[model samples]
Target: MNWILLIIAGLFEVGFATCLGKAKENSGNNAIMWYLGFLFCLTISMVLLVKVSKELPIGTAYAVWTGIGAVGSVVVGIFVFKEPATFWRVFFLSTLILSIVGLKFVSK
Candidate 1:
């Protein structure tokens, strides 16, 4: 359950990052809306992180959290934002995915 919350929290971290990107790409009311989304997602992500950290080891949880966010944001950057998906970029992301999975297995 805690792990699930942590994953959700990590996803919200992606949400905030996406919102920031969208905000940067817009202006006027549209930018304001994206900024509001960023704040909302950031709040929820932090709350869930705090809740899950109580049950999980802090170091493991934090690493996993950031790992998920990094991986997700990169994927979003490639897909949604049309960022380049170079070979080395994908290779590193694969490693990051493996490490996140490994952490889940090694933890708790």
Candidate 2:
């Protein structure tokens, strides 16, 4: 289904973001590899988003896709990058999730 594809695309967005962060953390050959990974994932994410947008409303598709990416990226930052886990951060992320779900339900 288109929604499933959109979800996958959102995941790819997370992948690309992770790759981008990793790229900056590496050096020389590792850096190049990470950069390539970032590019590959970013391209795939964009393609999938375009496909989903073709069948779904552009605003809804973009919002949900970016919402998933934002939430996933923040979680990764906490776990992988050892970022702070403030209560307000978690609260806002939860709010974003609710909004994404609401958009899905209201969307055609």
Candidate 3:
């Protein structure tokens, strides 16, 4: 389904973003490696975005895709990267999730 592809694409968005953070921690060849990984995942994300765009409304698809990426990246940041888990941050993330779900239900 297009929605499924959209979800996968969003996940890859999170993947590339995480790679970007990792790249920032390194230098020289190591950083280049991470950057390359980021680019690869980013390409996949964009490809899927374009694929789903043919079926779904671009505005809805893009908003959901980015919502997924934003929430996923924040979760990875808190858990994998040990970023702060402030209450307000979690609260806002919940709202974002709700909005994504609402979009899905309302989508034709």
Candidate 4:
């Protein structure tokens, strides 16, 4: 259950990152809306992180959370934002995903 929450938190981290990216591409009201979304997602992500950290090791939780966010943001960049999906970029992303899964297994 806690791990599930942690994953959701990581997803919200991606939400905030995506919101910031969108904000950068807009102006006025649209930018403001994106910023608001950023704030909302950031708040939820932090709250869940704090909650899960109490049960899981801080180091493992943080690393997994960050890994998920990094991997998710990169995928979003490639798909939604149309960023380049170079060979090295994809290679590292696969490694990050493996590391995240490894952490989950090794962690208590």
Candidate 5:
């Protein structure tokens, strides 16, 4: 299903983003591996998202894809990268999630 592909793409988005951050932090051979892996995943995910977008409304597809990726990456950044997890940051993240859900329903 297109929606399934969309979700997978979102997951890949998170994967690529996390990998990119890791690549930035490391040096030497490990950094190269992470960078290349990130690029590969990002490219594949974008292609899949484009395919799904052909059959779905652009607004809906893009919103869901980006929303999932943004939220997922931020969570990973906080837990894995030990980025700040302030109360306001969490509140804004929740708002983003709610907006995505609202958009999904309204678009449907």
Candidate 6:
């Protein structure tokens, strides 16, 4: 259950990050709505992350949470936001994913 919460928290991290990016691209009323939504999601994600950390080791929780968030956000940035999709960039992202998986399995 705690792992599930952690995954949800990681998803929220991606949501808030994408919202902030959209908010930055636009202006006026929509921007405000996006910013507020980002803040709300970010807060909720943090709270859930904290709860997960209590059950898992701090290092494990933080590493997995941040790794997923970072990788997920970058993927969204590439596909949704139309950022660069260079081979090197994809290679790095794959490396990060592998490292995160390794950590999840190897850590006690």
Candidate 4 residue lDDT tens string, 1-108? 999999999999999999999999999999999999999999999999999999999999999999999999999999999999999999999999999999999998
What are the per-residue Cα lDDT tens digits for candidate 2 across 1-108? 999999999998999899889989999999999889988989999999999999999999999999999999999999999999999999999999999999999999
* Candidate 4 structure lDDT: 0.98
Against the true structure, candidate 2 has what lDDT? 0.94
In candidate 6, the residue pairs with backbone N, CA or C atoms under 3 Å apart (3 or more residues apart, or in different chains) clash, namely none
Q: Give per-model CA RMSD.
A: 0.4, 0.6, 0.7, 0.4, 1.1, 1.0
Rank by lDDT, descending?
1, 4, 3, 2, 5, 6
| Local distance difference test values of all predictions, in order | 0.98, 0.94, 0.97, 0.98, 0.93, 0.91
Candidate 5, residues 1-108, lDDT tens digits: the string is: 888898899999999999999999999999999999999989988998999999989989999999989999999999999999999999999999998788767864
Model 4's TM-score against the true structure: 0.99
Which is superior by TM-score, 1 or 6?
1
Worst 10 residues of 1 by lDDT: 58-67
For model 1, which pairs clash? none
* lDDT head-to-head 2 vs 5, winner: 2
Worst 10 residues of 4 by lDDT: 99-108
Give lDDT: candidate 6, residue 24.
Answer: 92
- By how many angstroms RMSD does model 4 differ from the true structure? 0.4
Task: Output the lDDT of residue 6, model 1.
Answer: 97
Better of 2 and 4 by lDDT: 4
lDDT of 5 at 28: 100
Tell me the TM-score of each prediction against the true structure. Answer: 0.99, 0.98, 0.97, 0.99, 0.93, 0.94
- Indicate the TM-score of model 1: 0.99
Q: Between 2 and 5, whose TM-score is larger? A: 2
